[model samples]
Target: IYKHSGELVAKHAFRVASGLDSMVLGETQILGQLKSAVRTAELAGTLGPKLRQLFDASFSVAKFVRTETDVGAHSVSLAAASVKVGERIFGSLSNVNVLFVGAGEMNRICAEYFVSYGIQNISCSNRTLSRAKDLAETLSGDYFPLSDVAHKLEKFDIVLSCTGSPIPVLGKRAIEKAIEARRHKPILLIDLAVPRDIELEASELEDVFLYTVDDLGEIVNDGMRNREGAAREAEKIIVERLVQFKSQLDRKKRIPVIKKFRKRGELIVQIELEKALSSIAKGERPEEVVKVLSRAISNKFMDEPSRALNNDSTGEKLSLSEALERLYGLNKN
Candidate 1:
């Protein structure tokens, strides 16, 4: 593990929270994950006050970056890319019938992306019709059984398939026949599964435009490249916010020392004032009493600090003496 002290620690966390260090560069989901981890630690009684402040500062920096710059603009996720490719082929998706195969997480996300893009007609199919129906209801669409996909394929203008099946759920012949039934009106097929829910051979058929996960990844990468400028802008914002946060952190660290120093000075003032009053009551000259009081107060305040300086090792003493001089603005004088 790497160790960073003072401001560097906050710099690292702020950059990561803002997605500057992410693989997709400006990807923003990681910030949410960090917040979730923070909540877990809070629930377990592990996060201290200082650590909580650091995370809170990082979150503030992330939100500021999002507002001031386009760091999270042009999202490069696969779900968004699927919609991009659909628009490329069909001009617009408002009139298209979308078939979402496999009501799994990936398919559900893609279905949501399509619906959010204003695609009115969509259907869901799964091995278990209940899951598909649930997803369909969530999207306000219709549901069909996986077994019926082959015969019903022609009804959809776009087919998005992602499943955990070890074998292909869609074959070349199935797509080919669907094209014939559609009178070759052109169909867009997006396969986002690892084992490939749609057969690779389906790409060879006419009027069947197929895109795999790798293809969408390339589109996402193109988006990542386009966001480089925004990422740099966010980096600049981090540097500015880091400096401001560091100053605030330093002041917070000094608060206890400031309180103790003020308390000790007050005690010295009270003790010396009593001594001065006694001398005046004993018939000492006013000048003599005032002179003695001032000298006593100064010596008493300096006594502990003088001893501390004398007790330190040579190097520590020199550094501490210089710091004290600067703190008192003695060097400036």
Candidate 2:
């Protein structure tokens, strides 16, 4: 419910979407979260032009930072770190089988990253069949019900679980059985849920490497420290963006003044041209008509500024020529 105005909101949104404020510095998942939140606000009728503009600028800033800086080039998120750990163990993921235990946002992101690592066989199991199927279809993987996880566990060499169950989804016994079924082949288990998805005792099992959210903290912190330079560069970009956006807004505010001035000038030109044309039609000299039209337009254009300069009611020391020079950025040299 925090409210901000002017550049404050813009700055905050830019930092957040660029991942400067995230635990994993430059993790791209926050950008999607921000976009989703913006879309939700739009559907709820709470998004306005200013907010939309700020978010649009934020998206651009995030993309620019990622492209220009190495902010997102390193493994930052727990999900990505998990994939890295898996790659370190298996040397490559193309031949390994991966199982994602939930179809939530975090799992979705993790699945996408794993697929990018060339994982050919990926499966998803969730409490809801439809959600699991949707995520599986998106990743070109198989979907199964949560109840089938135990039976299918042995087939996966890597298991990433982030379900919201209050109790542990896979205990030591379940993992032990899976290990026995695999003939003691090694398995990499990553539990990313807050309350813990895999049982704590599962870490003690042979041929199993179990890692939890706490285990990923060191990696996340290291990533943050490594990206400090890139983060500074991103901050500079945000500052420049703020100044640019403000300049654009200022120009937008002056548009009406410009339009009004142009309209008035057009009207004056129309009146002067008609007068000159009538004078010529009435047999006046063409040269005289041309001279009168030029002088009349120039006089009309200067009249308001001349009067204002003469009045000098604002107590400023600017002379007529100086005022005109300042207004138009004219140089005497």
Candidate 3:
């Protein structure tokens, strides 16, 4: 009832498009992260049945996208786009030394992408030297102190930054000094952070090519068009899955009614059993007492319904019987 329906719908759409699950089946970071978020909400008691249903539907839709369509085949990711942009600018990423400004997930992904492109001269710098060193060691890149960026910025031809700080991590003046030190060599800088790690003024420099997250939008849009047809097919699968989930939810709504009916039946049995025990205390034989109690209780329960059916002349009892059968899972067919 909290209306998580819209969020669930969007989550389903995103998981299919983001290559979190592709036809080729690569790494599944996005899907795992989404599931973890849902699980956290559930643990916090913030998730209701509606949201739970929606998330379950989203996961099912993601599965359908992976199995039923080729949308994920040759998928283009943000990190891959960074590497592609690097290749486009320098013509060969192998000769370009790469530097990452943060030890976050995005930075790690970009570093991995660069390394995969044979770019061995890589360096990582962070506010915390230990974190930077850890990421550098895993990627086999050199680690630099955050303060060393001023001295070392000129060393790398491709600079990718995504720090969490609100302020710009790389200023125009800092890049200006780095550019002069490199003797006007072309440098491609990618800023994937939201608040923007690289200053916009740096783009005005002659030899520096700076790209923000917004700049990657055009590239991502172009790649998305190629997969539009498959996306449409995946949408159809998602709708079908949602319908099935909703139908199951509707059926679950009948559970309370069934429970109430069973509770009433138990009460009737308990009352009759008490009466039988009282008769046993008055010297009734145990075997005959049990047999008589069973028949008497059965007759007492069914007598009213038998009399009503006999008195009804318009087949109303048949309708009631059908309704009860449907409710209690006693339908003949």
Candidate 4:
């Protein structure tokens, strides 16, 4: 599905989850992720006009929710749950030395949340040291080569791993050595990777706490229910925004008509100006000639738009006029 209509479907999914088409509205993380996903798809050349429109509307709805409702004002996102889990294991994140494996998007987000919790001694290790360094700069942390994980594992009180490796990066024996080096000081490990970064056996060892992405699901579900009422209000805001977006999109379809009108008006102006210039060159008074040319051009320009406005039987012209009025800030009192 992802290969064929993945981009479009993902974009629509974001719209729905963001409350643009949701039962509950203004869920911030989903919308932001949706936008990110859309951008990624666009850059990959997988996004088409249909998907783009849906994603754009979704973004509009998400923005409306942020501005018009309290849905995102007090929301708890998955990132927050990850931080909570870290806090639960360590008690206070203030003094914990943290190392993040992988400089991917999820790792960056988790690092930001950890920094928010007052973790200062943070570092990142990735296969590409440059990528790790780039992410480290954002969090004001240090970077190390991925191979150094074994040597430096004991230094950090917490390890958050999420990389694109097929095999486990941290095995049971390696963690066991790190735990022994720390003299049994507890190490909290949060693995956000899909195929799993830390070996499952590491969780069974004493003084090493491991929480995978699945473990955080419960916390997120609990947090989601707490804001159910706010979500409904957000959904209402999204629906209104979606309707407004559709109206704007429909108005955009009339661009060719507006373009044709402008083109014809310019052509008429050019022909009349040429005539007026020819009359002046043939000994007509310069001031009088200029005045006549100005009036002629003005009349010619206004003629089509005025005619369309007056001879409007169907409401298409009225709708177009209203759209233009709103666009140009022209008020008819």
Cα lDDT of model 1 by residue, 20-75, tens digit: 98877777779989999999999999999999999999999999988988777765
Alpha-carbon local distance difference test for all models: 0.90, 0.89, 0.78, 0.79
Superposing all C-alpha atoms, what RMSD in Å does each candidate have to the true structure? 6.3, 6.6, 11.2, 11.4
The Cα RMSD of model 4 versus the native structure comes to: 11.4
- Measured by lDDT, the strongest candidate is 1
Cα misplacement distance, residue 252 of candidate 3 (Å): 47
Error of 4 at 78 (Å): 3.1
Clashing pairs in 1: none
**Candidate 1 vs candidate 2, lDDT winner:** 1
lDDT of 4 by residue, 147-215 (tens): 999888999988989999999999999999999999999998888898999999999999999988888
Q: On a 0 to 100 scale, what is the lDDT of residue 286 in model 3? A: 86
Off by over 4 Å in 4: 1-75, 229-333
Q: What TM-score against the true fold does each predicted structure earn? A: 0.64, 0.67, 0.49, 0.49
Which regions of candidate 3 deviate over 4 angstroms?
1-75, 229-333
Q: How far off is residue 235 in model 2, in Å?
A: 0.7
Report the C-alpha lDDT of model 2 over 1-333, residue by residue, as the tens digit: 668887888888888899998876787879999999999999999999878887898899899989989888766778778977897778778889999998899999989988877787999999999999999999999999999998889999999999999999998998999999999999999999989999999989999999888888788777767788789898999899889888877898899999999999999999999999999999999999999999999999989877877777555537666768888788845
Runs in model 2 lying further than 4 Å from the true structure:
41-47, 88-95, 99-155, 159-218, 314-323, 328-330
Cα deviation of 17, candidate 1, in Å: 1.6
